[model samples]
Target: MALPSRASGGRPSARATDTALTLVVTAVVVAWTVVAMQYEDEPLSSTLVGWALIGVGCGALHFRRRHPVAVAVVTLAVSTVYYPLSAYDGPLMVTFALALYTASAEGRFTAAVALGVITLLAVGFGEAHQTGGNRQIDDTSLFMLAGWLISLVAIGRAQRTRTAYLHEVEQRALAAEREQEARARESATEERLRIARELHDVLGHSISLINVQSSAALHKLGKKPEPSAALTTAEEALEAVKATSKDALRELRATLGVLRQADEAAPTAPTSGLDRLDELVERARSTGIEVRTRTEGTPRPLPPPLDLAAYRIVQESLTNVTRHAQAQSALVTIAFTDADIRVRIDDDGRGSADEQAVGSGIRGMAERAKAFGGELTAENTADGFRVSARLPLTTIGGTQG
Candidate 1:
């Protein structure tokens, strides 16, 4: 059979180790054979044939790792014939034992077992038929030999099983690493989207109001160029613009602090939450859109993420009212209960019913609500457009009672 590329030359260190081992086996076998012959009066031709068989048997082991079954068979055949024909019975069975071990370690257990059985039977039968004054193979010798072969096979099988188990563990570790990397990438994407939503809510509301006030100021000043009246209107519009711009810049800076590296300073300004709902309402009212806000039930402190999500949902909803629903007035109702908080915004404007389905502002609000295990619904009501959200209240753990 053809050898795999890995078995032939994958590891240089393994090749070197195997070469040294083969040399050692060859030396031990040759030395034992020479010593045994010193006591036996064997003929020159018989000794020469024994030496040739020893050379072939030991040399075949060089490719044992690559072709374990073939080597095991060759060595077994050589050893079986050598004991019967050679006068000097040296340690020729050692080479066959090593080959059997290699076969078992290489995952050729069935072949190794078959070769071992054949070797035992052939050697036993040959010893039974011999009549010369040679060293006899007794029952104890056969039992000892069987014990040695079984031990080698057991040890080799254990090594094979250990190697397989280690390989499976490494594969499991690699799979876990890949899953962790995928989760990390998903988290990064969600963070980017969150930052984008924050920027939009912060900047969009202020800029839209600024544009409306500026346009109104210019129109009033142009229609009636009376210095007394136009200057006063211009002054009020500019003041509103200045205040809105400053708030926008502060919030923008705070939101962007999340993008800074770990070593850099974070923005110290407190995050906007329910405490700043009045400020948000005032800003929306500045654009001549009457914003009425009311609270129901008792007010309580909320977890930071839940509070932030609640505030953003309201802010984005009001911003949408100013930009899309040309309504003159809107009502925001916040209701706090023992288990959850609800916020509802209703505007009496002729806005498109499909706006809530397609608008990014509405989508961002829904995402925020979902992140907190809450729910949001935006739909056209009999009066106009309505956006409502209900967020559960709990401790730091994201569970709702």
Candidate 2:
């Protein structure tokens, strides 16, 4: 069987205090009854029975919190009977006060009011009966009843105030938790988008260079007379691969460095739009892959993100050709229209049915285009695969820095 819950575990200090109070009050009541019997010359039997009733009524105090209404009713009944018979005041009045307090504290306001009324009536009627018709309404009894009623109302108000305070605290806690969860989710989404951007920048450029260099090396190898030249071309291509891998690692490490250190430095600057297109194409030509480049309309400076996005689209398309297509040549077209800049990479490569599911390269390219308020489309035509992207110049800004 399971242990009791934390809420059910009795408060040791509170329970001990209650028990001590009950014991002390019981002793006092018994002593008072004995003294009253000696002074009034009452019989010993009457005093003894009164002491027993007070003791029994005091026992009800232990269960006040658990059964406030019942305890209150029982104490009121016993006090009504024992008050007239005993010369001294009984413990029932004290017990009744405690019962009223417990009822308010435990959220039983209706029961507390009823008990208070009953107690006042019993006290008034018992006094009137004891003195016969000669007894008059006195200030002492009125004052005592007023004090009890005030105490009951005061306890009820205090309990209500505490309950309101606790409810407000709970609402604030729930709101804070919800806000924290929202912030975490937002941070995760931003990180994912940042990673996508980095992958597009790194892989797109590196793979394009590899495709170009490998083609150049293969062409030289075919010449048979240029073994040394072919070897040099292969070496250069390998060097490019190593450089690409190093750059990728550096970017990745920078992104993840925050997890390891509190004072890590920021990442290095990224490559921007159309900065090294000439060198990129030339390197590929040095290999065996033939690339033709064309530009239409006046070439204007573009936003950093748009320029980088344009570069990535072409780079990824060329990389795909080198890896999957057996084509001999590729074409890169850039058109600066009145409102937008358009890019297209066409290659004479074997197109497969699952072109969209090629690799992360395509997905990264698409993500880059979307980030800049642009669109990317890929289609496998009869001759080869085509990748195209269009970005609005107005939305992203004028040019790369």
TM-score of each: 0.81, 0.72
Candidate 1, residues 226-281, lDDT tens digits: the string is: 78788899899999899889989988988888888999987898888999999999
Query: What lDDT does model 1 reach?
Result: 0.83
Give the lowest summed-lDDT range of ten residues in model 2: 1-10
lDDT for every model?
0.83, 0.69
Show the lowest summed lDDT stretch of 10 residues, model 1.
Answer: 1-10
User: Candidate 2, overall lDDT?
Assistant: 0.69
lDDT of 2 at 226: 65
Give the residue spans of candidate 2 off by over 4 A: 1-52, 125-130, 133-137, 189-193, 196-227, 238-262, 268-271, 274-288, 291-315, 327-344, 367-376, 388-401
